[model samples]
Target: MKTNVAQLIELPKFLDKRGNLSFIEEFKHLPFKIERAYWVYDVPGGEVRGGHAYKDNQEFIVALSGSFDVLLDDGIEKKVFSLNRSYYGLYIPKGIWREISNFSTNSLALILASTSYNQEDYIYDYNYFRNYMHEKD
Candidate 1:
């Protein structure tokens, strides 16, 4: 079984005397096209988000402000990534379970997706997701 692992992508940062700049162009900095964009904020303390995995959609997540930790699991292995910069993003592939946690105060999370919203694409059960990934092997 091959479990795809997420990787960190450093976006272009153009420093200027006025302010800093960063950009992520679809198919240029990401492995997929940008079909959707969203942001997560106002998360209550001690609360977590993203307890599911997508079947066909790929996502790129960035910490636009503050910091947070992303846990990725692929049935056989698990890794944690700390996102604390606006110029860097985590590229999450399909079939991998992801969870977001430990968000700092007033943190902003920007997510770029490859596909539009689809309820059927979500895998909400951990056991079901594990089996589904292995079945592909």
Candidate 2:
């Protein structure tokens, strides 16, 4: 069983005095190899995203616009990330429960996943998730 762990993802910095431009390449910029990419937006404040954990999938998230939080829990320790920068990203390892909330209107949450969509890989129920983790012991 895997668990959520707090990790930092390095951001790409572009050099330009007048007009700067930075780009994030899926597998190149992020540490773990990426197999999928997705972004979240058009959300109202107070609306929360993410309440599930993956079996082996890892993710790296970024705030492309506005600001929001990346809340993580390893079924034990919890942490929050306030992302307002376009250049920074958060790395979320597998087995961790995650939530993206407190979106500041029109915020864009970009995510790079380590695996393609696999319904069976998702653990949506909290109790089941806990039980699954314990079963691994």
Query: lDDT for model 1, on a 0 to 1 scale?
Result: 0.92
Sequence-dependent TM-score of model 2: 0.87
Against the reference, the lDDT scores of all candidates come to: 0.92, 0.82
Q: What's the TM-score of each model vs. the native?
A: 0.95, 0.87
Provide backbone clash counts, one per model.
0, 3
For residues 1-137, write the lDDT of model 2, one tens digit per residue.
Answer: 12245576657778788865667775576656789999999987788999999989999888888999878887767899889888888888888888889999889988989999999999999888888877776
What tens-digit string does per-residue lDDT give for candidate 1 at 35-105? 99999998888899999999999999999999999999988899999999999999999988999999999
Best by TM-score: 1
**Which pairs of residues collide in candidate 1?**
none
Model 2 residue 10 distance off true place after TM-score fit, in angstroms = 2.9
Cα error, candidate 1, residue 87 (Å)? 0.7
